[model samples]
Target: MPFIAPWTGENVPSPAAMATRLGRAGYGIGYADEYGIADRVRGALWVRVPVKPGAGGPLLGRIHALRQRQAMTHMLCQGCGQPTVGGRADQRHLFLTASATGRPVAEGEKTVSPPSCAGCALEAVQEGLPSGRRYVAVLVEHAVVWGVAGIVYSPHTLAPVLRDVGNEFTLVAYDDPRLPWTLACREVVALHGCTAVDLRDLSERTPA
Candidate 1:
């Protein structure tokens, strides 16, 4: 894909329009003491013109820009931006990328994308990606926060900064330094106690 999962034709506030705005006003998130988790958790924010992102634009738009945290914890659907809590507690909801085959979801594994609803998962498997990257649905009871995906800026200057050593374009983590301000783009979390399920299995079931 051209756009990320949430940025697909489904989500609102066109990426082209947002990109156009960013181009005109310059693309860079501001430094803040803390970022709102709910904003990034849901794909309800996007960039606006003159770089004056709306209420949730600054952080949420950055998240959307990188296509990172399209979904949040507790089986939040990456496709339709809804809670996919599933019918039973043990059997929640899940949607996996092809790379998730052998890899084990450890206690602190980082997840860029979020879970998908049964309907969206099926839609993806049917005609989501042009390359046909296989995605799997799963049942999970819980998850935990890991970190975030955003640019680190200098609080004094409010300019996006990067690791001094490695790639000049690299960003720092949330717990790095106070000077290197962190603007969270993605709310990463680790999936716990998951049980893989087929899309057909969820056909008769969905999150409430």
Candidate 2:
């Protein structure tokens, strides 16, 4: 059988499952040995079960919906202590790079201008500006540790930062509580360790 996520078009299947399906179908050599279409077909069938309409779709759809919800929940800004519903259209938030001494440097400052609302502007000020040295350091460290872009949160709104930073800096949200703290540790380790953070191990250790 082949695995398929009907709603999202994602594929899923185990090697053993693929082999068994191919063998039962009278296919030779088994999918595991060849790693060809036979294997893909089997995997797709495994996930996209031949069930009634709307059966398998819900599973993938639900996950996507949850992610959307998380994104919306974190869009609010933390600065100005209010939602960014009526923020200026021309204003933007700026994020400055920090130096070795932990002080914010203006050499490669990144700006996120025309924030949709005041909340977003405040979040940029507190999380990206030079005044927020400690917060920026924590966010950068977390990104390095996770082998991903850094995460920023809105203090007043408890929302995550969602925007672009720069080529070297990627902006991400703190949707998961533990993710922020974990990234902070990884950043410190990255300074000394050659290996990147193992996402699988981190997932297993943390709870959703």
Off by over 4 Å in 1: 1-75, 89-91, 98-107, 154-180, 198-208
Candidate 2 stretches with Cα past 4 Å from truth are 1-74, 78-86, 94-102, 105-208
Model 1 lDDT per residue over 21-80, tens place: 121123433212213343222322222212222333223222343333434644456556
The estimated TM-scores of all candidates read: 0.51, 0.19
Candidate 1, run of 10 with poorest lDDT: 16-25
Clashes of 2: 24
TM-score (C-alpha, index-matched) for candidate 1: 0.51
Per-residue CA lDDT of model 2 for 58-141, tens digit only, reads 442122222222222332222222333323242222222233355432322222211113223233334443443332211111
Q: Model 2 compared with the native: what TM-score?
A: 0.19
Which candidate should be chosen as best, given lDDT against the real structure? Answer: 1
Q: Pick the candidate with the highest TM-score.
A: 1
What Cα-based lDDT does every candidate model obtain? Answer: 0.45, 0.26
What's every prediction's RMSD, in angstroms? 9.7, 19.6
10 residues in a row with least lDDT, candidate 2: 183-192
